[model samples]
Target chain A: MVREQEFLYASGRIRALETKLLSRTIVERILEAQDMDAVMRVLSETDYAPDFEELESIYDFEKALENSMKRTLGVIKESLKDQRVVRFFTLKYDYHNLKVVLKSRILGVEVPENLTTLGEVPVEELLKLSKGEKDVAVPKLMRLAFERAAEVYEETLDPQQVDLILDRALYEELNLLVQDIGHDFLKSYLAALVDLTNIKTMVRLKYMESDLRTLKKSLLPGGSIDLEFFEKMFQEPVPVLIEALAASNYSKVVKDGLENWVSSGSPAVYEKLVDDFLLGMLRKGLYKPFGLETVVGYLGARENELKILRVLMVGKINGISEDMIRERLRDVYA
Target chain B: MEVTLGQVLALLGAAMAVFLPGIGSAKGVGMVGEAAAGVVTEDPSKFSQTLILQALPGTQGIYGLLTGFVVMQRIGILGGNLLPLTTYQGLLVFAACLPIAIVGLLSAIAQARAAAAGVGIVAKRPEELAKGITYAAMVETYAVLALLASILMLFGLKLA
Candidate 1:
């Protein structure tokens, strides 16, 4: 049995670590850098220097930053002595790897050679799974997940459908485990994640004019909305769908996105709006009475920070002016 | 002389009164702490602001403890019993603990979540930290009110 006290102690260590997030001033400094070399000079003063030095191009720099993040995350996970929390994070990586593999197979794209491999199943195992000849050890370790995915794959008889099913199933299983921990902090974070993902998928489906069956298949099972209610709302026209969602916590920005999508016949802005809203929500929700949410919220903020950095760095390298980049930047809370 | 059951029940109510709010505050703090840690890992410079943001939901626990203390005082544990009470009278005091304890516990957790999200906002847009706090405090108001009512009831109760 995991000792709750140890978890709390580890959480204290995490608290100390949270004192290191980049400030707005730092972000601004990085934004003002004239080139990638200048950006690297600024980054060298911070903890993000490890992979920042390995890049030959803007694209390479972004990839390296992503790799560094994964590596740092791996190190942090190792430092955590609490097995359950470690397992929870590992499952997240596992899901992420699974998604990448499935996407590569379906799109017939080559798997990136430098893909981070921190999940228990390993990169080799994922590669084998992608080739449709699952290895015994990996599948055994992921038996329940593989079985569920296989069942969905068989029933749907469509690769895309199978992928969607697996995604939803993995999220449900992970969320159930989080709930069983009985930590109120984890519960709220998980709930918010589920809601965000469900809403994003709903909006995407609406944009695609997907059939009802496909839309239903895309929705995750354990969001704030009941399946029946979600299906009903999803069936409405796009404008009505926005109106229905406006009643929830995500109203302000999502409603704005819906209006934009209706007037312009483009969902791009709405997609960005959703991202901003979720990021904003996570940022605000994490700081109070600090615990697990703080850790997760910090991780999310770091991801956004990196995204912003990458955007700025690329814009600078491509000779895009600050004004253009600023105009294109989505509000963090929109 | 037999010690009345009313006194025993009142004692239990007082204990719950103190413990429940404590639980709520601990839970609330834990939620926000997790979020803060995650943000700090990526960018540690936002530490001061994040700490402030994460600490906001912890008031519920403090409020709960205060209510518990007030209840204890009213029952004469801290002073002389001013009135004689029947078993049903003690039950009313015990029942009063529920609204504050339950609401305090749940609302603190929820408010912490709102605060966690707010912290994320601050990390990205430091200018909007106040707005985020306002949103988080919106959830905290009900829990505070519940705690206040419980305290008021404990003081108003006339033990006879």
Candidate 2:
């Protein structure tokens, strides 16, 4: 109880900050803009004004967006009393950087300098860990995953193995962190993420015409949908798998993604569905007065808004149609 | 003047009536301050509005002190005479104080939660601050009822 009360100030600040987040109407206005310059104009009206104003070229919107995300995360990190929960939000970025570094090492390509700074671990440290220094400040879980992924890639000489191993490790470590905090909402959120990832992996592997062995290797642990159920899914058709999961919580997402894949031969709709579902789960935090929920919810919302802006900006720059951009836009948390 | 066991029990009751609810109000008001400060930090314009919400939980402490004052007066402590009483009468006075001491402590905490939540409303919808105040003010009813109960019981006690 005392611990929950400690979040009172942070949660309230997040509530005020929530008002400043990009709303659906603003996104619609951005989409309605006729050209890239017009989209920039719309974005300039937001908290991104400073970044947008400083953009030397319209194409450099990606850098501006990155700056916006970094600033948002930095503010959230400062307000939070418990760094562990906030770190959970950024842990994915660390794994993302880790994946890029490991893959580039295996391919003998130059490590990209544009690595994200959003991770809990610094990119410089991640780069050092990639050099097999072993003494860097990376979390033990990630360091071990890094070594394991390196060893596995050397044996198989396959790049995909690195992603699977690292992805699994990310979730496993997230599970452990949430367990340590002892928050049931976070535990179940992680479970839902695992379940959705497994479902997405299954659908993608099925589309690739991969064998059952690869499918078995890709499924993650700790989701409510166990390995036995996924193994059963491997034998059945996509629709049958959807029906099998009908009684579970993910039936709608599974059905939407699978049906879209079956009809359009693409997993795009499924990816959107998964994001919307997770946001829906986090939306429960909006009503909570104090606790981890409000902080996590605001963080999730900010990340989602950043994602929406990225899609909009990329679409505008690439000259993709407004309707196409709208189709790809995920639900906003506000 | 010599202090009796009955007077000691009654004094304990008066102290509880003041301190217990005072502690509760302190906690409640402090919690609301933290939350209200968060809103004010983002937009200083909402200070007066959030401050109203912060004060909502403060009534319980006043009710507690008022009850304690009434008890002191009835016992002649305020009159400088110091009424002598049987042990049973002191217990009766002790029992009267419980209504405000217990209820004031609980209601203040509960109201603080409501008021802290109201800070969120003010943060998001400044126009709806009234509704937030209304919700937190609903909790004040119980504290008022508890104060009335304690006051009525003290006045009804036939200590003489």
Q: Give the top-scoring candidate (DockQ).
A: 2
Per-residue alpha-carbon lDDT of candidate 1 for residues A218-291, written as tens digits (9 for 90 to 100): 88766677777667877677678667777788787678877887787776566667667667766642444344
Provide the TM-score of the second chain in candidate 2.
Answer: 0.98
For candidate 2, lDDT tens digit of each residue in A104-190? Answer: 787677766557878778888888998878679988889999999999999998998999899889888888888888888888888
Which stretches of candidate 2 lie above 4 Å from their native place? none
iRMS (Å) per candidate = 7.1, 0.7
Q: Residue A213 error for model 1, in Å?
A: 0.6
Instruction: Report the C-alpha displacement of residue A136, candidate 2, in angstroms.
Output: 1.8
**Residues B53-105, model 2: lDDT tens digits:** 99988999999999999989999999898899778889999999999999999
